[model samples]
Target: MKLSSADIARYVASDISDGSYVNLGIGMPMLVSDYIPEEREFILHTENGMLGMGPAAAEGEEDWDIVNAGKQAVSILQGGSYFHHADSFAMIRGGHIDISILGAYEVAANGDIANWLIPGPRPPAVGGAMDLVAGAKQVWVMLSSHVSKNGEPKVVESCALPLTGVGCVNRIYSDLAIIDITADGPLVTAMMEGLKREDLQAKTGAILNFVPKCEILKSFKNEA
Candidate 1:
């Protein structure tokens, strides 16, 4: 079976190094906060002007004034602080972020990402994606689906939508596999248990190179 969102989040959280200043994009990327290792320390950054954010607020304990960029209620760690929006972006653009885990609509094998704008007429909200990709020390993508709802591959040879950042992605954690964007190309470092290489390739739009030892992913829970 393919990994669920929680499983993927756990994998991503475990891969995060200790003492890193990280940013979590909205949507599935937000789920990562619930799974970060208890022993590890991470200072979560929110684009809406929050630093050192904690997990989601419990039921009826939410303070609407304190929310993430996605407007979801969240708790602030002991030393967490709120600042001006400009200062929050300054932290991103000034290269202070260690990693930014973002959700992607499409990720090219070359590491280009397109998540902000589709082909629709709705006004686009690029948000902080461009800044995060350009300024973060590493950019990791979280893909909730290997393919779109319409059955199109989300990992493609090239993105069809407008580029978010050119050759900026460093890694990808998907429901099916963990891929690294290397100089050679997108390398499959791990795959879901019981999934065949051919099966994964069929769901992807790009040619994939596998590492010598591709590990199998198992279901995981939030230990926090």
Candidate 2:
């Protein structure tokens, strides 16, 4: 299946359990909140010191003080609260967060992550990603199937960039497929509609083992 970045985000949101204490990383990770069911209770924690975060606000409702790891203006749900940055990290480092969804540049077969920095000149800053990767109970990665604009594979034998966390990722939700890192290898748990296992393998750099289909649960319905 040809899935877009938004499809990856929706996939991540669908897996998040109700009442999960989640921390979203920068970039595409921020979009997961948009797909969450409003009636379900989930508390979003920002590493910069806010909790109970609502989705991105409407045009006139943004509060500068309430933002996420991306520093974009956000809103607070009814039971939302704020705290100090140190306390926020404390929660993360203490493993209080149930899941942390992050964007990645590359992920290895062993679940090693390399998302914090680009490999060339003018590299982006490595924010709280390192801590989140190491601390969260489960690390969910949202990214594309390939690396570089040239369509190099992002799922690789080993990451070329500086590492974010070794064996830190639990599940990967990508544009083309959903992968779970197991002792055997990177298992293709699910693929987008119409995409074949061979087609996905051609695009991926890592050795992929296609697990037989089971009763897979639908996570999100396309609204648009």
| TM-scores, each model vs. reference | 0.94, 0.89
Against the reference, the lDDT scores of all candidates come to 0.91, 0.82
Candidate no. 1 TM-score: 0.94
lDDT per residue for candidate 1 within 142-193, as digits (tens), equals 9988899999999999999999999999999999999999998889999998
Off by over 4 Å in 1: 221-224
TM-score of 2: 0.89
Clashes of each: 0, 2
Model 2 whole-model lDDT (C-alpha atoms): 0.82
- Candidate 2 wrongly placed segments (more than 4 Å): 145-147, 214-224
Clashing pairs in 2: 1-195, 147-152
Model 1 poorest ten-residue lDDT run: 215-224
